[model samples]
Target: MIRHLVLFKLNDGVGRDEPRVIAGAQAFRELDGLVPELEFWECGWNITDRPIAYDFAINSAVADGDALTRYIEHPAHQAAAGQWREFATWVIADYEF
Candidate 1:
């Protein structure tokens, strides 16, 4: 399986309560059922206030690298990610398990 992880940090002057952020998060939350390649999915805001912490995260898995690629290229995923492009920056990691 391939595990895909993402961490997002809002840009300076951006806040979680903003409409775009809320919609972006909602878009991610809805993807588990929308994307067929997802074997597992979880995402949410960071509860901790530590300086090293990211503001949001996504934990997801797929059958293999091909499935992972499909997930990444999926149109719904593209739109969700596009929302963040304007207000946040993110990092991602993928590994086989």
Candidate 2:
């Protein structure tokens, strides 16, 4: 399986309580139900206030690279990502397990 992890940092001055940010996070939270290629999905806002910590994170799994690709290309994922792009920047990593 492929473990896909993402760390998201909100842009300066963008708080997590903002409606747009809340909606964007909700969009990502909905992906597990909307994307069939996802074998696992977990996402949430960070509670830590440390300067090094990201504002949000997502941990997901899929069968393989192809499945991961399908998850990335899924319309729901795209919509969520598009919404996030307006207020945050993210970094991702994928590894096999």
Candidate 2 lDDT: 0.95
| Candidate 2, 7-73: lDDT as tens digits | 9999999999999999999999999778999999999989989989999999999999999999999
Q: What TM-score number comes out for model 1?
A: 0.98
Best by lDDT: 1
Worst 10 residues of 2 by lDDT: 29-38
Per-candidate TM-scores read: 0.98, 0.98
Q: How many angstroms is residue 63 displaced in model 2 relative to the true structure, after the best TM-score fit? A: 0.2
Which residue segments of model 2 deviate by more than 4 Å? none
User: Ten residues in a row with the worst lDDT in model 1?
Assistant: 64-73
lDDT of 1 by residue, 15-81 (tens): 9999999999999999988999999999999999999999999999999988998999999999999
